[model samples]
Target: MASNSEQKIPTMSRQAAEALIAEKMGPDRVPRKFKIITDTSDFFRVDYNDVVILGDNPYWVKRYEKEGRFGLDDEPKYWVRRAIDLSDGSTKILKLVFHEEFETKIGGISIRCFRSPKKEARILDLVAEHPNFMHGHWVLDSAGNNVRILEFIPGPRYDQLIIDYGTDHQDYFFNYFKEVLDQYIELVTAIKFLHDHGEKHGDIRRDHIIHDRECKVNRWIDFDYNYMHGESMFGFDLQGLGNILIFLTGRGDVLVPELYQQQREVFDRLWGEDLNISYKNRVANLQKIFPYIPKSLNRILLHFSIGAKIFYETTDQMLFDLAKARADVIKLSGRTS
Candidate 1:
């Protein structure tokens, strides 16, 4: 027999919890744009136990310090947690940007730079039609803080997929490589859609690209660093894509240490010498290091990496070349089959 205190207690499942929250937070009160959380306090409750306070709270600061969580400094800026709507039982990811005051040489100033969440919301709105981007659900405000809720995407990071499938499996490398290349092409297509609409995803990295294997969908997230329309923004993103391709090809530092080390030395010597000269030298070094890359694909990668031949002046050009490369691979596969 178990003691009364040791008896198991039933807990609500996530669905039941969300349903209860939704009932509390009336659907009528939910706004299309961001509103302060305090404004809707009558319908929602904050669970303090599971919250991540990003502001300058001494208690939280000390707690995070004891836990050895990185990025907690003397001055912090945001708080993040999950909240439930009492009326409808819907759960939302909440972010709170704090208000601050500073003293400068001239005088005292109050700064409310809580616009990042709003900016992200706006970007999401712009690219809402595209399935590859995350959707912004709502924005709320309370007191002097701003809150943003985004649709949560569930998947593994692009790099994680490479790690799980790329190592200790030379026989499957080609298949995996083709799959990655196909995904990369789709990413390029999505980025092109953004460019066509006059927007730029400033950050493009392996971690930012999430792929749902079951659904066969790729979502690009973390638009906190996104940029507005600019003539050169497309080129900047293209360069990032080139770097991502290099990473996915298993030629990065972790996968091929000796080759990366050699490339690093060359890159170090040419650092800041001249942008064009350095890019050209690095691409040339990569060609020598990763000779397994198909010649056609190598040329396409070089166009983006070096920008000397101007083979990919636009996203369309790159996509066309990629299609051709895929077709060539298919033909070769058929011959072997």
Candidate 2:
């Protein structure tokens, strides 16, 4: 009774199989010999000294530090450090997840600082075949820590592109916008691939999407919060995609607190008085606020964002529409040029 698709399930490699097993068994089951990478620079050092090697021994950790400080904490704990691969003598980017007993309460439950590098590694392995996903070179596992060696995708972050070219240059912005639309279609294709395999990217923020100018491809990164095969979180990824489109259209300024407050009265009246409006209604409000969105694309966006409409039941459906929109833009651009 096996369908052709089910019968064609590819055999997982030994390493990938081991990673899945290790993930299911948790961090405690990871091997002790496998070294875990950690940040040990003067500014911010990981507290745990017994388990892993400090990555910031002699190398410059300046560029590796992210922009914002972690919470009220002054220094950055998590870091992306360069490590020399002993097997090949080449350098690789090691993503270190180091939290120093930071605790916070969420939804009436106390949560402690914890890293899920194994889970991330497994998810990376699952999506490795996808062109848009960043490859996981190797996973180093220790009793208390896990280190993932990810492919160092060289490119400017999507947000950086928005900052550099989103405004002040009308022609360039339109060209870049077209490019972003193409990239968004490609992203939808990547997400379709994930959904086909029964996985969902739980987090799909703008920063996580990188446009590699060298490869001319959009790479999706950070599987830290990815959800494995599940039915409960079905439409959340669609919502994330909608947000990304809104950002790409340069209307992200509308998401600011002041702007949101300005539109709150109209939003409530239009979408009814529900304080916690649905994702679809939220997107509909976005459509209402930004009436300048092109008709061809706005239809697609509204279909995905509006609660009552169900035109895009799957990522493939959305992908098809996006591809058409991209092609239409290209044709229009050609004519204008």
Candidate 3:
């Protein structure tokens, strides 16, 4: 039940993309070698029709070297290298992610650095179907391993977009933000659709929300955090949307009164009674940061924030309404100006 927006994007079938990458990589590359470095159960299926051998002595391979002491948690078990064919000189990276399953409250869920083959296939299927997010990544079947060949998306992250351009970038930023807003709406719509399809995205965060300003589009990148709709941690997805709103407003680190007051209410509801921070001081600060923010909008935000004190059972719907309200105000002001 993916939305029309979700279905509009053109994505290659997992099998078709696999076939193309396999043909390009050629045969007799890995000598039919299959490696399993994970200490977990191997519940993987192999596709002979989509088999591709990774070339020997790949030149463009680079491991991410960090300046930290190596420990059990800091080990790198994957091999990532780029390949460039000489004939037409086409290039792609061969990404291999290895992982193991562990028992958790969420059941025997995978703790992969990347997703498992089935999860990878699901991503491919999503990308093939949704092209607006600018789908360029592909997954190749290598015997039993899942090899990801992705088209590089290079740009500043959406969070950085505001900082880099600020008010001067408002017009450009508005266009970009609108496009991202559509994608974000679509993403949530898709998540709701997934919930309808008996699936859910357990982790939806600003970090996972990717935007390419140059392309004027946004994409939700990692499906590794996806899960079933009724999964224990399902509520995190909605919380993640609130986090996205905080980022979109570009009020990062500003600590507006409305937001603080709203958060205070939630804690009070959970623990009962308000905290020490005076509403007078909080309101004082909002006056300083957003002196130009319309009083009507400020009042709405404050009222909505207070509603959070009551346990925020309807915060998601409230947020969506607030966003539409803000957008409408902006539009009305633009017309008057």
After superposing candidate 1 on the true structure, give the runs of residues whose Cα lies further than 4 Å from its correct spot. 1-47, 50-91, 97-115, 143-146, 166-173, 227-231, 251-257, 260-287, 304-313, 332-337
Judging by lDDT, tell me the better candidate of 2 and 3: 2
Q: What is the alpha-carbon lDDT of model 1 when measured against the actual structure?
A: 0.49
Provide the lowest-lDDT 10-residue window in model 1: 56-65
**What TM-score would you give candidate 2 relative to the actual structure?**
0.61
Predictions in order: lDDT: 0.49, 0.53, 0.41
Top-lDDT candidate index: 2
Compared with the true structure, what per-residue lDDT tens digits does model 1 show for residues 1-337?
Answer: 0011112222334344333333555445333332222332322233242222111100001011011112353332234445443333444445444332332110122211222555555577777777787655443333323345555456766666776665543423455666667778889899888778766676666667877665668888765554332345466567667667656654342223332465575344332211222233233324444445566776665554433456344678788888886666555434332
Global Cα RMSD, each model: 12.6, 11.6, 10.9
Q: In candidate 2, where is summed lDDT lowest over 10 consecutive residues?
A: 1-10
lDDT of 3 by residue, 39-118 (tens): 11222322222222332111122232111112254443334334432223355444455553532231123322323545
Flag regions of model 3 displaced more than 4 Å.
1-94, 100-117, 132-143, 167-197, 227-233, 255-323, 332-337
